[model samples]
Target: MRIQLDDLQGPEIHALLEEHMRGMHALSPPESVHALDLDGLRQPNVRFWTAWDGADLLGCGALKQLDAEHAEIKSMRTAEQHLRKGVARALLAHIVEQAQALGLRRLSLETGPVPGFAAAHRLYQAFGFQECGPFADYKLDPHSVFMTRLL
Candidate 1:
């Protein structure tokens, strides 16, 4: 599969992001939901990418600049049919490589704490992310789990 920068304008990507948002909302409370929407992902400091196998969308992920030396992972989601197929792992690896290329020293992310998010937590842990307090504009939230890693 190939991972490429996306413009967030394609129907497939739009649908995937919508599914991500829906899943996030269902897993956490409205106020605890931090997943970026389509417009939010279009911000200047955020870079979005989509993983594809030929014409099929496999997954998507994004990196958001929090400061000169810190970056946040955002909008990570694998297409339903692509689960357990290494799509998320490849997309996350690509995001980390991009962050390192940009000279970011730290990478952070926030995800829900429910069992529904166990696989994601495991994935992050495998990539060296550890639990931490909220960063950026985030505050202490029961439904939210914050994690970070030094690159």
Candidate 2:
């Protein structure tokens, strides 16, 4: 699979992001949903990416720069058809590598406690992320699980 920066302008990418947001909202209560919408992902500090296998879109992920030494991972979603295919693993590794290249010292993320997020928690743990309290504008929420790793 090939991974590259995405501008969130194409129909395919837009659809994928829309699906991601819908899924997030479905899995969590309104107050606990933190997934960024299309407009939010377009913010100047956020960099988004997509993974593709030739013409097929496999998954997408993003890195948001919180500060010189910190960043947040966002919008990590694998297409339903691509689930369990290692698309997320590859994309996450790419995100971590890009964060390191940017000289960021830490990478953190917030995911839900729902069963749908089990694979994500395992993946993050395998990458050395440990559970942590919320960071960046986030408050303690029973539905949200925050994880972070040092670069």
Candidate 3:
């Protein structure tokens, strides 16, 4: 699988982002969720990517530059059909590598706060993320579990 920079207009990437937003909205209340939509993600600070197997998009992730030394993970999602196939793991590892390569000393993220997100939380923990305060432009929200890792 190849992970490459994504154009926000890419169909598969757009669909995956929409699916992630839908999943978040369905699982959590609107007021509690703060996922970036297409417009939000297309901002100058974010660098997005997608993992592809030939013509198929398996997963996607993004790193939003908070500053020269800090970044935030965003829009991480595995296709429903590709769940449990290590797609998300691969994408996540790619994100970490990119963060390190960019000389970002810290990486932060926001996820859900329920068992439904247990696997994701486990994945982040395994990658060295620890519970942390809200970073960048985020606010403290019980619905959002924030984490950070020093690279």
* Clash pairs, model 3 backbone: none
Which lDDT value does model 1 have at 146? 96
Would you list the C-alpha lDDT of every candidate in the order shown?
A: 0.95, 0.95, 0.90
Candidate 1 Cα misplacement greater than 4 A, ranges: none
- Tens-digit lDDT string for candidate 3 (1-151): 9989988887778888889989999878898777888988899999999988999989889999999999999989898988998888999999999999999999999998988789999999999999998888778888899999999
Model 2 gets an lDDT of 0.95
Per-residue C-alpha lDDT of model 2 across residues 4-57, encoded as one tens digit per residue: 999898888988888898899889998998988898999999999999999899
Candidate 3: lDDT over CA atoms? 0.90
lDDT of 1 at 24: 92
Model 3 Cα RMSD, Å?
A: 1.0
True lDDT of residue 121, candidate 1: 99
Give the candidate order by descending TM-score: 1, 2, 3
